[model samples]
Every structure is written in structure tokens, then in C-alpha cells.
Target: MTTIPVTDLLGSLRSGNSTAPRLTWYGPDSERVELSGRVLDNWVAKTSNLLQDELDAEPGMRLRLALPAHWKALVWALAGWQVGLETVLDGGPADFLATDDPAGAVEQHDAVIAVALPALAMRWTGELPAGCFDYAADVRSHGDVFMPHSDPDPSACAVRTQEGRIIRHRELISGFALPHTEGARLHIPADKGLESALANALGAWQQDGSVVLTHPDVALTGKLLADERIHGS
Candidate 1:
């Protein structure tokens, strides 16, 4: 078994369990979205292409994620990491910012992205700032398979936060001792921050398993949990 970096884990999942559910998301409006490993990888690929081709996003670029704990938000974060961009959670300086609110972005950002968390809508339908682009709309035109323009050094910094810690891809993946194996379906709450939630979810994926994402805001009963076949409480 080869110990691959977190960046390569998604590709492994796509090839190993292409049709399995990689993530199942529920919105506050009782809307549900299920993305298989292949589908999720397609989205990530498209998003990476959008960032690299259109926005001129390069590896080592700092990106601030201002979206909520939605599935698309996680996809964008993974896409950024795939492009070798550092995902900044701590309100630090960033080269680009992806947010639901254009006004919330800092003035120093070179690019601003508006993400509309649409349940069934494919793209954002509202107006945006002159320079800001709608993520959903723009990503539709990109290719489904992404090829990195330039490979990044694996030992280089992959993520940084106001926590004053920088982590590399190998370190982040190796740090978590996940017990999930291939096709494991793990359930997690949305109360966790993006970093924590993604860490656990990706850890599950690291084992070639999928994640059943849930939220405290959404009413979840024992029946619903059982219906999803969630293994544990």
C-alpha cells in the first residue's frame, strides 16, 4: 500500500469507488444532495480549472474561504488544495477570497468569488461586484478532468492558519489515524468548523470511505439516521 498525499487521495477514491457516495449533504430547507466520488472529483476538477485558467490562481496562492459549512464549500476547498493553494481559515492575508458576501472580502484580495449555496440551482442568479465572479456559473464552463499546470513540491507548505501553524500535505494526512477502510460510510455533524469537519471527512476518504454529512440546524431523528444506515451515534 502506498502512502499517498491527501491531494492524491481523492483520485484514488474516484478510481476505487467511483459510484459510491463521497458526500451526502442536507440543507436547512430539507434539500438533500448526494455526490459520488466520481461526481465530486468532477466538481473539484472543474473548480480547479476555473481557478487556474480564469482567475490565474497558482500554487502557493493564499485563499480565504468565507462560505458556510455547505458541500460546495468543501468542494471548493479541496479544489484549492488540488491546485496547491493554501487554504487559510484564520482571517489572514489571502490572494483570493471565495465568499457568499462580496462585501465581506478584504481589500487586498486580487480576486473575489461569490458562492450561492443553491440547492437545485446550478448557478448564482444575483448580481455581483464588477470583479467578483459566481463560482457555480463560472465553473460550468471548465473541463471535468483537471491536469495541474505545474506540479508542486510535496514538502512545501500546503495550509496555514491564524493558529500560527503551517502544515504539509503528507503531515496532515499522516497525522490522522483513521479506522475507516474502503467503502466505509462515516457520519459527522456540521457543528464542527470547516477545518475540523473537512479534516474528519477527508480522513474518512483517506481510507477510501465516504461521508454522510449532517447538520444540527436540520432536524435529525433516529429514523433519519437509521435510514441513512449511519453506523454509530
Candidate 2:
């Protein structure tokens, strides 16, 4: 698939080839959830719709992301990028933000989105600030397909890295490790950050591969690999 621009990768996932397993995330408790490219795209769409309809996310908007290395974080990251917003990972200034602690970030950003990190949490049981919006509750009611009013510039800034420098989608896409085209199943250590997770999953998807994500507690042995039919780590 062509991946010069970042949206091309998203386009391929949405329509070009949507039925394959694109990402499989595992929690620390051994719980797992496999998302096909279509399902993943649907999540991105819902998140994008929420960001746009509720938070006024638009091209060039600054979005601060304070999420952990979890599956929902991936959805937020992709959705933010899909809306042509700059992801501020360094806790810098932004127009909108996503964090577990919405109270702290609400003062800085226009709207604060609170994401419950628990695997099966339908909503946050903790007491949230009055202005905070639950990501789980808000995202579920949005549309499943994203149809942008205008295509964003591929050369536009996509992310502000930890070092506080802007990076484009093409630059990020070029850094991936694209392998063969077979449906390769990968088993990965689950301790990596959200950034690493995105890179690893994107690299694997470039090869038409799936993943078997797990925490360190889950020992990855050959027997386990054979049982899961995983081809790589």
C-alpha cells in the first residue's frame, strides 16, 4: 500500500483492505481485544466525530494527549491526527486535551476529555470535574465513519514529540519498518509506551500482519507462539 502521506495509511485501513486484523491489544491482566482494520478505523471515526462535534477539533488545532500506552490511546492519537490536529505530547499548550486527570488539564485546553484506562470500564466511576467529558461515554455515540470536509495537508505538522519539535506525517510514516505482505502474526511485549505501540503496530500492518499483545507476566514461549499462531515478536 502507498504510504507517502499519513492519511494514505488511514485510507488503506478504512477502505482499501478493511477485513484484516490490524491491531490486537492485551492488558496487564491477560485480557485481549483484537481489532480489525475496519473496526480500528471505526473507532478512529467515532473519536474524530466526538472531537469535531463536541470539542471543535479542526485542522491545525493543538491537542494535548496525556494518555498511557493503552488501546484507547491509539484511537485518540489516530483520531486527533485524522482531524489534522497537532498532538502535543510534552504537556505544552493546546486547544484541546485528553487525560485521565481532566481537572488539571482543563485550565490549559478548551475542552478536557477524560479517558478511563481500565480494560472493561464503560465509564469512569471516579468523581470527575464538572466540565470533564468521559471519553468512553462520549465516543460511543458518534458516527462510525469519518468523512472530512476538507483533506488536510500531508506536509502539515502532525505531532509535537517529547523534545517539543514538530514532525510531519510523511516523516513519521517513513520511519516505519515495512516487511512482507503475508498476514504475519506478531507477539509484542506490552510494556512499551503508546508511541512505541503505534510504531510497532504500523510496521506490522505494513506487512499485512496482526499482533498478539501481552504483558511481561505472560511468558512468550514457542508453545505459546505456536498456540497463538504468531509469526513474530
Candidate 3:
């Protein structure tokens, strides 16, 4: 039996040695979910194809997404990771300009070759700093196949936190502990499995991405997840 590090899972596929797929996200419907299944040899194979067809052809090879802190953005984020690209998660149009310099700060830390922001943010009627692309319509022009230019490298995942500076995959993996409950390991999207209350709780807790605290007086478990804003504050 071999133990695998979750952080290295993406890297394994890029190396063309691993075939097992991992479900990185659930869906809004809870049932109609988005998962990174091993439908091919690896994720990089799919990402590479998509990059070559759509993303790479776009104005900038780099992208910044200004979307809500919902699962859709998470899907986009993971896609960016698969292609070894940089992502700037913005809180939408309201914070667009205010975030522009902050976003530039992120780009300064790394060379942001292209931009991948949501349509709403790009067309917020505010002045764009120049050279920004509309990801919504542009992405549709490309096919769904993900073709990576290179293999997945664990060291490649670079994300910007609100606190300041950059954080890499290596640093991210060592910082957290997995929850012991079954619910903490698997995450069921909010609308999914509503009938299966226990299952929903199990999924949420298993993922360890959510914080489900209890209100003894209310006798209910409150769940929290990472979104555009901080979770479990």
C-alpha cells in the first residue's frame, strides 16, 4: 500500500504515470457536480488540449477571474491550476477598481501573461487598466478538451491570498489537518442530497472544507465553506 499526498496528485498526472481521478468539487445542485475524474490518462491531458484550443489562443496566456465566491469560480480556479496558469480571484464588479492595484500587486509577484476575469467585472463600466480579456464569451469559443502544454507540477500552483503576497502548493499542503468525521471528508453541494440530511452532513464534514458548528439551543449544525469571502470567521 502506498500513501499519496493530495498536493502531489495533480503532479502525478502531469508526469503521465497516474490514472486515478480525484473529485475536487461538488456542484450547486449537489447532484449535477463538477469532478476531476480520470476520464483520460490524467488531468493535464485534458487541460493541455483546452489550453491549446481556447485559453492559449486568447489575448493573454494569463487570466484573472472576477466572479462570485461560488463553486463556479472554484471550478475555474482548478482549471487554471491544471494548466499552470495564475488566477486572481476578485469579488466582482463592486470591488473591481479597488482590486485592480491589488491585482497588479499579485501580477508583480508573478508574471501575469494573460487575464481571465469574468464578463461582469470586465464590463462593469469602470475603466479597465488596459489589456484585459473577457473570459466568459472567449472560453465558449474553445473546446472542452483540456490539453496541457506541460505536465502538472506541484510547485506550479501559485495563488494570491487576501492577506498579501503569494502562496505555493508546497506551503499550502503542510498547513492543514484533516477532520475525523465522515461528513468532513466529502463535500456535497448545498442543493444536492437535501433529502439525505445525514449524508449531506457526512459529505460536508468529510471534505473538511466546511466548518459545521452546533447551536445547542437550536439543536442544529451550522456549516461554513470557503467562498469569495472567508469561511468560519
Candidate 4:
């Protein structure tokens, strides 16, 4: 299979089919949110900017993502890769942490980013700890276009998995083990955990395909399959 570099994959998403929905989310209470390629890129750029500018994140720094398998979590992973932070999915020690529970994540990281998972959350619902950065509140203030201070080192570690595997930046696409479905709208179940979700999403996006991510509580019925035009799972 032909593989594109992680950065190049993101570039294609932004420039190739900017208006088409790249990610569709289905949550509880019949809540649905969709992000087109351009919008997804914009969100990633904003988050990347926030990481780089606000947190002083640089290449090789570890970013432990304590988020669930949701749209926002995917955005955080993509942004971390964009800014060259080593994404840690093992709940291990790291330079920074992006999580829904800031109070629980405060002890081990240099900084903590509180994430609000609701589709329309303008800010964190509760009062955050004194030093925590509220993702919803601070991300919008950053630039939509991300200009990295320096190019990422391809040899640097990109992902540190729970099973103690390390995937380097250059290997992310080529080493991706998921089945590829070109131009297919794939459905990814959230119960598979964040790493699997991220891997599947990356494979879909790499092939100019899209993903419909369903929250664990959202059942995958025939109606949903037909409505989302899902071709694969």
C-alpha cells in the first residue's frame, strides 16, 4: 500500500478536499458533530499553536493524552504530532497532559490541559485548577494556521504505546497495521480504546477516506450505517 508521511497526510486533508466531512462523531442523546477536512485542519492548527506557543512544547517532549476515544482526543493526537510532541498513550510520565479530568492528571506533568468533550462547550464547565489550561477557552485565541518554529525530526519518537512499543515519526504511516479502505467511509467504535481509534482514523484519512466515530454508548444500528454511508468498519 502507498503511504504518505503524517505531515503530508494532514496537508492533503487541508488542501485536497477541504469541504468534505473528514470526521463524523455520534454521541449520546442523539448528539452528532461533523468536521470537514478544512475545519479539522483548522482545529489541529489551533491546538498545535496552543501547544507550541502557550506550553512551549517542542519536538521530543512527551505529551500524555489522558482523553477518551472522542473527536477531541483525535484532534489532540494530531496536534501533538503536528507540533512534534511524543504522544504517550500509556498514562506514563510526560512533560504535559491533556485530559478530561484535570484534577486527577495534575501531579505528574509539567502542565495540564483540561479538555471539555461536549460539542458546544465554550469553556470548561467547572472551575479548573489554578495552573491548568482550559482547552476550549485557550485554543480559540491561537492562530488558525500553525507555523512551527522548526521542522519535526522524523527520527524522533511519535507515539509511545501502552504495550511499550515506540513508533517513530517516519514510521507512523508505513508501519500502520490497519486494513486500508480507499475512499470508504469507515465506522470506528470507541470501545476499542484510543490507540486503536487513532490508528484506524489515520489509515482512513491516509486513503482520502473519512471516519464515523461512535461513542461507546451509541449503538451501531442499520439506520446509522445507511445514514452515514459507512462502507467499512
**TM-score of every candidate:** 0.91, 0.86, 0.41, 0.96
Reference-based TM-score, model 1: 0.91
Candidate 1: lDDT over CA atoms? 0.78
Q: In angstroms, how far off is 105's CA in candidate 1?
A: 2.4
Model 3 over residues 32-87: C-alpha lDDT tens digits? 22233343223334333444553342211343544333333434444554555544
Tens-place lDDT per residue, model 4, 1-233, is: 22226678889999998899999999988999999999999999999999999999998899999988999999999999988889999878899999998986676788999999999999999788888999998999999998888788888889999897999988888775365778979899999999999999999898899999999999899899999998645
TM-score of 3: 0.41
Model 2: lowest-lDDT 10 consecutive positions: 172-181
Rank by TM-score, descending? 4, 1, 2, 3
Lowest summed lDDT across 10 adjacent residues in model 1 is found at 1-10
What digit string (tens of lDDT, one per residue) describes model 2 on residues 96-159?
8788767666666688889987767889877888788898777888998777755666677788
Model number with the top TM-score: 4
What are the runs in model 2 whose C-alpha is more than 4 Å off? 1-4, 176-183, 216-224
Error of 3 at 133 (Å): 6.3
As for TM-score, the candidate ahead, 1 or 4, is 4
Alpha carbon lDDT of each predicted model: 0.78, 0.74, 0.35, 0.89
Q: Name the Cα RMSD for model 3.
A: 11.0
Give per-residue lDDT, candidate 3, residue 173: 36
Off by over 4 Å in 4: 1-4
